[model samples]
Target: MPATAPDLDSRAAAVLGGGATHAARTYRPAIRVARARGSRKWLVDGRELVDYTMGHGALLLGHAPPEVVAAVRAQVEKGTHYGAASVVEVEWAERIVAAVDSVEQVRFTASGTEAAMLALRLARAATGRDRIAKFDGHFHGWYDAVSVELDGAGRPVPGAGVPASMAALTRVVRADDGDALATALSDQQVAAVVVEPSGAHYGRSPLQPGFMAEVRRRCDETGTLLVVDEVVTGFRVARGGMQELLGVRPDLSLFGKVMAGGLPGGAVGGRREVMELLSPADGHVVHPGTYNANPLTAAAGIATLDLIVDGEARAQADAYAERLEREWRCVLSDAGVAGRVWRLASIIHCALDDPDAQARLPGALRERGVDLLHTSGFCSTAHDERDLADTVAALAAAVRAAARVRR
Candidate 1:
């Protein structure tokens, strides 16, 4: 097993940059998954680990969900690609439109990043403004426009490969700072004020109560389009995402992850007038992608959406997460570990008092046969009592291990 692991590791390093496709997927001691099903994944060495990543928040129904598998299987037999419009795609979009109140029209993209990019483009086109504003630490995607972060002075600092001039067009403000947000939008040159209603890092830094409503009001006052990046929250948080929970409507909403049923897909749904910018009649925003609403994705998405429409899946996941949150908080307290556990819907976040312990927590969990998405655990409807108990024990051990490590 060790011999095979090193060989495969070397091969991956040679072919795949960083030995992983996505940055988040990379691990300290690279893990190779052999297979997965229902809240657990087996490593190449045949080690089974409780999976909390849950397809990075896509698998609300859990891994290899039967309905999605059946749908994708049936679609593959019919056709993988038609090079034209698809009925499954239409149904998927219909479900999104019906589920989300703010989304009157929707357009699919290959990934969340692309969906975010499209939303910004549409906002700029619809408002005829060059500048955009986003809250600091609220990551929309990896695209140039949304890649910038704010420094300590609250100044916008663009990531590498972003032009200074392009960075100049963005305004960065704190998500909890309503006054700052108001001041940022006062100029009225901003096309869109994009945000994650749950705040940055999937509620690690949660929005203050009523912050979203205030954001909506500010956007309305300044005539700026509000784009909510719900890529991580859509479908997983609720049927309609954070906007529904917050009772605020945005001009544009981004969807991905759970909305795509663990497939590679994303979407921008928004007001009909603004979305019409992409229509042939308007020719305002042009979007083209090879895999936009591809049949496999649409099939999985449709099946996933159908199951979650009744809110049962979300309820189940949330219930499990609630238990996890309670138990984990107790674990930290009982173990005398300086950490706190919090949750937003089905997503659980564990923050250590020591920054180094926080950094080591995920790796420690992986070693204890549990995998997390950073310091967060994404619960699924499939997680049951056994998985919960095991995860709790693993978390307790991992916290102790992480806390013992010296800088």
Candidate 2:
């Protein structure tokens, strides 16, 4: 191992922008992971961290799960990519269709960003409309069409390089504002209203209980297609995703993260008529990618889905998350930290009531050998009691550290 992360960080910065490929992984005192398995990862310097990033909410079974690894290993011998349709892709699609209630047909993409883009395209083709509506703070992806930030008045402010005209086409509304949502959809100009069903940024700011149902009702009333971006929640929250838990069906569903079983893959699954727009028979839409359904990703996805479809993995993860949430709250109380912990399925969000403490919490936890995504933590089936105990202890220490800084 190198003496410090600087050598690796320099090499990364030389090749990759900001010394990281992903914005989230660009943490200070940069950590370079060498390998990961189960609930932990080792840095290049051999420091072990009980991981809560969990592949950015992709690895519900944890890193390098044996079953998924075996599937990928076996498929490598046969072929990596065929650049054409394969049996594995067909089987993978079938699994998704069977599991997701709204998905009658499925089209694979390289990432969740691509899936969101395709969902919007399909909605437009099917509805003959050009505009789309999305919730503020509900991130779909980095694509220019959806990479919009809301202003004080809730109007969209386009990200750099995104044309103002394009941003204008996307109507932005607060997730919980039923009146605003109804008004936006009532115009009949929106092709689809997209949302992260698990609320903004995967439950960082939780949505009200009936918000989803309200969105669905408004979409139906206005004939606007409902597009649920389940890229993070699908298969992780339940076999059918947030839809399964909420009993609300969408016209189109965006799936990634857990859907690909830790591999880089995504899909747009939904009504047959809308999805058929991609079929070349009518030539209405053209969707193509070099790695649309690479055999390796397909094999891994198939194995992962098989385990999760039974709901065993999800149940275990949710239980662990509940325990962590309860224990975290208790730890905060015992430490006299002004904070609260909440959960949505296997995902947990922690907030120090104080803004300064909240800002410092994640870094403090990192210093104590625990890694979280911002102030939130994701629980995986592979995370055991020891991991939970360690996390609680680390969180308590971090809270105390933040309190010290506040003092």
Candidate 3:
């Protein structure tokens, strides 16, 4: 017989770090998912929970959409890896170039982190500058070069294991602060100005209107390449991601998540001149990865991109998120809780006025059979009227429970 949830948790604790695969997934009583489909997951202990994580923003169409599943299954029969270039990858690249205006060329990577690393390298190579500037609270992946941020004193603070010398190469500027951003780029020693066009942490604290355009102008003035990290926003927020919505073209854009159709893959797309830095004939940046644009990921990415080409899938997901956001606000108001819910397309973030209450909210929601990605929710096209009703019901219960605990 399969081990119970508690038994699995105990065994996991003995082997896994903090009994969780990812740090964000750690909970006091870890919930074990047996299987997930559509907007719901079944726990090992037989409890059914409404799922809002949605593959950490990868499943804009929801878990295992038939088209994507069929694509992967068909490709699996061909082979997972050809060990050489395949036609599917070219088709995938063509889809990205056609969708995103800023992306004239595309280079696939194993994950978003690799994409980020490659993008910075390209920026540095193209500009012949070593320093990189980034907005405060903008996450570009777990790489050492992009892991540094400002401390309370506004000094660069590198993450553990990141060298101080390496951190010095990254100039941290506050998001939406045009003066500080301008100052960061005025030196002209900065190769790239990397940003998340949706703002920091996927819009928990959104950029003010026109902030991205301002950043783009500054980058142009300083001869710095603008690298927009669209890993979370790509294809989920729109068919072309945030850059399309904002009408701001970047020199380079990083994409993952929805573009890969719930699979593990990412790409750096940008102007031909900058992206060609990876080409051996004209440039010297050589990137080699065994699984880069492997057959399986290419098939899934192609299928996902095909479905979202017309933008209807993005519209459906956004509409669902809009309803969920409204219902969340109504729940907070009804529960007499001090909190606010905001959204960026399909991603929803819930914040309580009381920090302690906010901290307890996730646990409370889980108890009511609603699972969120951290404190945010990722809506999908697969969510329907039933999911809407059940999610609102769960939020109502969870808010009341959190309020009682606060009292």
Candidate 4:
């Protein structure tokens, strides 16, 4: 019997779909986490694991940090949300504006996906252009227009439920080469180019600094708006998000993840003149969300940002991630596993050189005593050398287990 999360999780799986609301939480052979504190999680069956997932990159300060939890508890006791304006909402806006580079004005949304949809709409209204350019494999969100990709026929197909016309307006290109972007933007009707400054898939396929700079140059020359999607990398990357790390400013930016500190939230920010397109002065764009800045989420966001800036948490996360990546690589290598590790700040992804390796990896990692972070791992201040060491050992053992299996 698995010695981890047996009590609460058995009940959770019986009632909850796959035992968790989020699909990522449900893994083969089961990994049941009962509760978390600081950077550690306690299983219902009494096993403990270092919490590297860190709320899917949302907990910059680590799991249930005392400062953040206290802020949340204080707010919860008062009330979870007011359904009306509050000082906390105002504080959230001010903190976001101060932290991000391209943002001079900002608006909140329920999730990062909503922010991406809003940014695309505002770009069309502002420029009066219909077409948009986005890189291949960069996830903007679950939104309609951004969800499209080229089908087997080499024709772009709308993601199910998205208006087909919206898909038609999107131009897809590879993220590897910046020069290809110049050719696409030659269109006068192109309203904007939306990019994830981290390259793609939360930096799984990263872009070189020069490639991003080149894209910026082309957008400026063509008079096309540049929208940088920072939902995963926003506050998690640095105080200013990827904009500060890349040193390139976008016309518009989408932020989420760590900003909410485990609560649901999103924000769209950029220059005042450009963001003004969403208001009465232009009468071209309007963005309204009933739960945009719910007091609960704002309270959480303010506390998260305050910790990020004051404690220099981003640097600390990066330092820890570097060591974690190196240790895992060595372990997997010594085990004669063909897998390799990739990282951006604290986000680490391990993929095998073998095309089929990933499908089996998530299962094998769980067999060893530690809960695998699906295909990737996150590093936080709450994790120590032992946690890092254990994860590396898990990777090594998991790889060996897979090696013994025949296709």
Candidate 5:
């Protein structure tokens, strides 16, 4: 922590249990952001950094983009929360339904976690099954039912505070293991099979190209619902999302991040019949949130979606990410560092073959004025050639620093 940060560390420790709201933000020598614009963030102590975290994979248009900010500012005067339906919410849902092929109806939630939970519940209600299947290492959210990891025997193991009984309800299968997936769903006991279409951990471990199609096939064969968790990839990877890129239609899609235009909101959008279960007419399921489709988020979402519906922003961001991937590979090669840089759409994943390099890379890059989420980076439409050059140079320096430390 910088001395000039003015008690950010102590304030964080006092207020935030882990000295940070999110685990990823709890880096040693913590940085407190004072403000951000475009692809850069200025720390509280006045240190400027080229940011790649991009709101933990939100902000597809980049930090505080003028249009989104303008919409939010305009909506602030009207009201923040009405606790009732609004035209903005209806318009937001309309855009989502129009964009996503599988979504005929949509329901809003306060976060992706809630959206996912509701999607699963909807699945259970539709299928009359209690079990859900998921790919190993595929993160849906922090919710207990979806937070389990696979054990040595490929069984689901719950995270701390999550009951083993709840974990057992989730069947974990290996990603890309067609046979395991088939076997898991063969019993027809599962209500849904959920996955991140961008692969596990948002492309840290990328999925095979045709694996999702296979999932779709298996789901159809087993009469199981396929729930695509597109919280990070929705509207960021493509206008419609990874489902559009892959040409697979999920029964239910969980969306957030870009969908809310950098605001805090999420949605469960899918087949009308399944989503209609939440309707009070039948009263099949109860779903409500104080901030669900709040006017501010709705306005921001509409504005953001309007710009990206043409796919220009997404294409530009993807092109930028591709360039960064190529350039970073060259950077690692030139430095005699062993690392791999790969990308999916606007997201970039870097993995150093050396454990020491892997461990030190993020901190080293931060010191060199670049910030990434774990080993990944997200490009935005706001990221330009200058940002790319700065990021590559910073990464190269970080690689060299890690090598020196290893020596």
Candidate 6:
């Protein structure tokens, strides 16, 4: 095996600027994926890898899932985008409504970011409030208004390009601090609270039992609306996303990733009266998109839900997660590597907590025939015990290789 990866740098730089189409994948070098199928991806340089990225949490059923592919193939023949309404869209919403306890009305978007933005708009319009509050580690879409702060020096620093004025309208609070949330809500200027119920993306933060209940209590006590961002946690976490698992209903919820079965699709679902504001008939808010409810996405989304509704696959994935999460921790410990295995059900994050850590994990893992998912790994329905054991060993070896490099 070559110590230095091949064609990754030049090819990426030549075509994709900064070596990637998306900022996250760019890293410093580049990550080139050739093709994927069933829990794995083959790299362009001829390396086969156990893929934990899985379309960045989109492939709940795993790569090129049979049902999802069939749905896409069938829909493509009927034509991809009509820029018009279709029955597939209606059925997609119906499935979402049935699965989630809080959703009565729904709107589709091209990405989860858009769904969240729309959710915020509707919340503000309906509540007649100007400010939106969210936990520190949670990331909503990249929209300027909501994307305006990062926890710097234990205080909010205005995110670049976010007007200092608009910065004042957005409030940043700790995900665990119920008192701070209450204060923001009491301001009466807060329109909504958007949260990732499991706190997966925010440092893999774990919400203490009843933390969600506290949030629900706070929202009800004040006039604030709650928006749960389920882009990463939607189907994979559980059938109805974190809301169902936690038993605390929010006023609005955003869905993406696994919801599309690995296609480009997103949605905002919530109570009827609030969502009614999005209807053009009502003089409140607006929701529009070129790819909104396109037949291809709708078909793919419907197929994805069909596979998730029964919760059998979810159970399998969660079981695998428990096994792998524990095994990885053990392996890392045995290797004398310093890190912690942080997980939320099937979602596993290996935080490299060591100060001496100096190697890039994606490169090290790729060299060992396994794909890296931003320091985390998700177990798919297709990953059985065999895959889990193999991955744990692979990660153990990769950590040794990484630890060998001179800082």
For model 3, residues 131-229, the per-residue Cα lDDT tens digits are 999988899899988898888998889999999899989999999899999998898999999999999888888999999999999999999999999
Evaluated at residue 241, the lDDT of candidate 4 is: 84
Q: Listing every candidate in turn, what is its Cα RMSD in Å to the true structure after a full C-alpha superposition?
A: 1.8, 1.5, 1.3, 3.2, 1.8, 2.9
Give the alpha carbon lDDT tens digit for every residue of 70-168 in model 2: 999999999998867799999999999999989999999999999999999989989999999998999998987788879897567998999998988
Query: lDDT per residue, candidate 4, 191-248, as tens digits?
Result: 8899998988788888875888888889898888999998888888777888888999
Tell me how candidate 4 scores on lDDT: 0.80
Model 6 has an lDDT value of 0.80
Q: Against the unseen true structure, what C-alpha lDDT does each candidate score?
A: 0.91, 0.90, 0.91, 0.80, 0.91, 0.80
Better of 5 and 6 by lDDT: 5
lDDT of 5 at 60: 89
For candidate 3, the TM-score is 0.98
**Worst window of 10 by summed lDDT in candidate 4:** 1-10
lDDT of 5 at 19: 81
Query: Residue 150, candidate 4: how far off, in angstroms?
Result: 3.2
**Which of candidates 2 and 6 reaches a greater TM-score?**
2
State the displacement of the C-alpha of residue 304, model 6, in Å, after optimal TM-score superposition.
1.3
Candidate 3 lDDT score at position 27 = 79
| Structural similarity to truth (TM-score) of each candidate | 0.97, 0.97, 0.98, 0.90, 0.97, 0.93
Backbone clashes, each candidate: 0, 0, 0, 2, 0, 0
Clashing pairs in 1: none
